[model samples]
Target: MGPAISLLPALAIAFSASQSSAQTPAPYSPAKSGFDFPIYTNHPPGNTLPNDPVRRGATTPPLHPDETRKLIQVPPGFEVRVFASEPMVVNPVAMTWDERGRLWVLELYEYPRGAKPGEKPRDRIKILEDTDADGVADKVTVFADGFNLATGLALGNGGVYLGAAPNLYFLQDTNAPAGSGAGALQKANKQTVLLTGFGLEDRHELLNGFAWGPDGWLYMTHGVFTRSKVRDAHDPDGFGVQMDAALARFHPRTKKFEVFADGTSNPWGVDWNERGDAFVSACVIQHLFHMAPGGQYNRQGGTWANPFGYVGDLPTKGLPAVVDWRHYRAAHAGICIYQGDQFPPEWRGLVMLGNIHQNALNCDRLTPLGSTYRAEKESTLLGPAGEALRAKTGATIKQGEEWRHVGPGNFLVSGDPWFRPVSVQTGPDGALWVMDWCDRYPC
Candidate 1:
């Protein structure tokens, strides 16, 4: 519940420069030979004319679930199966399980390829269920729709919270009857846009990554190139905060939003350990931050010197990452602290992270290092049938079809390019469930 007193007058707000609709970046030109892909292009600096071709055809069909399952490599004694895929569920960007064991999936049909400036929103949040106790989802219900590039999802406070960039919406279905379907949810659901003014320049980097903290506040992430000036919906002209590449905390009942940490570069995944200590996985940087209140981490576009005059020294600026990732661009996505009893006892408290670009799942052990923490990165997912794509992992390769890159240092890298893991979580049954944003590339 919200505080009795008005907390608005004491808070400070930062309003960044506003961009007109004309300033929006142009959509991908599918007409060009090299531009037919659905994902965005991140051209390496100084290589403007390079010709990197797409492996799949311009109109490549989605992979069937049976064929897709063979391409993935799970740990020994662990079996990976297709819980759901396209035609049944498409473009699953994010997912969270409700208390009743229902999986809520966020579908972003308009990603990398976004809706035109004036185009209406075309996204939906579907509730998936497995009624017969089968491993796969057998039912789907569209709980809400008509959202502009909705990228984040979390369940708390009697509703589903959605991050649609420039707007955060809460959809509550108070009057829905038992076993409600899409139509019933649509009729009973009430849509409330709680806050607005998030960055939208880059489609991937908006107000995303929603997770409820142990402290009862909702934690969210903003990526680099974002310019957010979020204000209270109740008081439109009142105070807000200018947030860029930072962790934001919003109290649902209080309607209070504040910056949890000051600096970060496109944080994509966040979760907590058994001890309630926060850990985060950042994109491109390939590092993990152990977050604390008021702590600052790496900021992409800012310049500051440390005590030793080291400019842009991230370790000095804030808490250093538990693991630096050492320049391997894994394109980290959703992360989770293994809390289920289904996995081996050794994996009980480890942090599991998904690297979408590298097609691998990684685990790390956080060991206390005085006041801060340090991590010992464990094994990575190995490519199937003993063929690892990266040479650095050759030594850790094994002989079986399920051979994972066993590591004191090696990673598990699935040789399959279609294995794009966007979110990794401990499923209701205790097996780790991975959401494959299965596409030619991530947008």
Candidate 2:
């Protein structure tokens, strides 16, 4: 009877095959799928959905420097000129001004994929200056080089604090002769790792958004997906704090590291309002959040790190987002509360955020709401003319099958589709300084 052959092997084979078939997803095809695929290159002129609001049409080819400037449309009495571009400063990711008013720009040349082991780092920090004060950067000096995926920079504590994943470094200019002040032009020959264990699982979600808090701590934003077990560089084997999707701070003098606030998806921007309330701009999930120390706010997804649960609650829900309304996409970066005098008086106290997917700068008015502030959509500060004008007129634009309200507009609008603004800061000259990634692929 064939030893009364057990049917176990046959049953197991059939079950495994069935499970595989169910688990494997089908390859994406535009013709077979209902989802709208992004068009990277410009479609033919006769295409019907040339500028489909949701899908977002193809990016225009790279425009000349002058032509790109011409495409930018600022409000009356304001002008958009080329501050520095290309050969002078390429792929500037983050910037911080020094005591001398020079712009220290972090050039992330090795983005998307950072430097591999044994490979020389391509990222660098350059100091751009308006020598003639003509509202243009005339001289560029290399401050430091040989950094891997450097995302943030801040000058303080007699040196520069740089956020390059897996390590936060303090760089000093050893070449500076006697008593050179902060931001002096000296070769950064001394490097010290203050803290380590920042995650690099995602290049864009590294330790970034460096800013000095009013409380004297060096603030930084650590994004979602990547888990961090930060420990002092001095204690490599000691117990470390585990965190992700959090606002972290470090004290250079004490060499202490702390996870200030928790929860958010890829928060790329952090800033404080006039009242010293901390606000953060995240991507994918909610656009803005008011973060407090030891606070566990809502994250895009995932369970909280506290196994015991927050505040003794079994199912801990996080705090709410400051912004009430939703934009077409929630990908926002670089938050700035307009404290500059270059814009009109009404612009004061308005929260300016970089709407990456929409290729514009969005403004929001903040009102005190208990401990946190409520953010209301103010206007599309910068975008395409047709879209901005339509928004101002309270019209609706066709998005897929539904027509959505165009919202409002007030500031600059660049007709160029490749005009991607990643970071916005009020310059020392009181003018708004925007860092344009200027690329077709935002990710």
Candidate 3:
């Protein structure tokens, strides 16, 4: 057992934002003719793209699990024990270890670096049971199936929320009684389709990443799948024409979703500091093009819409929203808010994030500077087994990258751009748990 602390006390104390209400949106005009398959400003499709290390090393060498042994990298001194290994289903997108200490892993259909199109789904909502209290998982069972690739999942408040393909779904995890066999996880109940209608263009930019922020409101991001179906155009607060909204915070009581932020590409993770402000993973837009440089999609700048800057305060119509979030190329996945009593006050409110494709995990300690509080990367905790990867890799990284297709305009040329996700959670044992493709944990 661990020390007890309030999860959303900040929402009640110091939480003063405008009131939000939910209403059924009326119909809107049809989409423009050119709206069939989306094309970025400049994408040169077809021809071959420059080769990337991972792409060229399509015959990549052996990836050792012990790559992070170098670099005095250690997180908060919390004793970490691998709760499970070879987590089975590709990259373990997100994980939630409930109050009862039950662990849930949302498996992404495709994994490793740069996920492509053909390998879209490999299925199963892997639920693990450690019944014996021995760190390792004693039982593994399918919690749910038939998913187009689930990216995030968490157990909070009273239910379990999953980052399903098109939207977020809430399932009642009344895992069977203690004596009940592994069969308990197999059956999923109290299924509620929390939100719907995320444009399922290719894979990458679907609306995903849901978690209860420190403020207590349900938060979700409306990834970058341009506007397939706009809910409300008459609504004055709408961003503009030709784009699906970006992010939003939902009020269960009111049953309405208010746009939290806009003008960004697909964002991977959403986490808030102890004070309740937000931070986005800001995933780039070109991953889908999956090609080399000089192609149409490969523009002069690197993934412009959301580069190195994590725009914050995502807001919708007067509500406090994501003001900004930093940008990282293919920064797909992993983020969480840690407020454990075990760590010193200095470490209490930090936001931790994981990157699947980048093969790294990072953290941004929240600090209050003068008038406002901002996030700064405290450490790049675990990076890809660089030296080892290089030692084993066949070729030296190629210099310049070129591509065949010139794209519809400028931004959609090379890479296939599939989505990558990293789910973060604070376990019952008072330790932070992160699951990527190869490893995860904290005791």
**Cα RMSD, model 3:** 15.8
TM-score of each: 0.79, 0.80, 0.58
Worst lDDT 10-window in candidate 2: 5-14
Candidate 3 C-alpha lDDT tens digits along 1-443: 22221110000000001111123322312212111222222226664434543322223221212211121123223222334434223345555555556666665543212234565345446776767665546577777765665665765545566766445676665665654433344567667776554466645555556676555666665555434333332343644322243555666555455555554456556766555556665555322111111111222122323333333333221112122344233454546667765545655666655544433344555556454455554433322223222444443333322111111111111121111125555666555555433322110
Model 1, span 1-443: residue lDDT tens = 11010000000000001111223324322111112334335667654533432222123444345443444444444545445544556667777777677777787767655666786767788887768764456687888887777899987766778898778888888786655542334322688888888778877787777888899999988786777888876678966787887778899898899988766677886788888888877776646788888776666655322223234555355556777654234467777787887665766777767666555666677788887788876543322333442343444443442324434332344555655666767665576666666555544
Candidate 3 segments whose C-alpha is farther than 4 A from its true place: 1-46, 54-59, 62-80, 87-89, 110-122, 156-159, 172-186, 189-194, 226-245, 285-332, 342-345, 356-358, 369-371, 379-421, 438-443
Candidate 3's displacement at residue 165, Å, is 3.9
Best of the candidates, lDDT: 2
Comparing 1 with 2 on lDDT, the higher-scoring candidate is 2
For candidate 2, lDDT tens digit of each residue in 1-443?
00000000000000000111113333311111112223333467667554544345334445555555545544434555555655666676788788888878887767757666797888888887778765456787887899988999998866888999889999998777557766665568889998889888877788888999999999999888888999988996969878788898998778888889888889987888778889999988778899988888878766567644355332236777887576547767787887877666777888777765665666778888887888876654433334644544555456551112223432444555655566777766566667776655455
Global Cα lDDT for candidate 2: 0.68
In the predicted model 2, the residue pairs found to clash are none
Model 1 residue 148 CA deviation (Å) reads 0.8
Note the Cα lDDT for every prediction shown.
0.62, 0.68, 0.43
Indicate the TM-score of model 2. 0.80
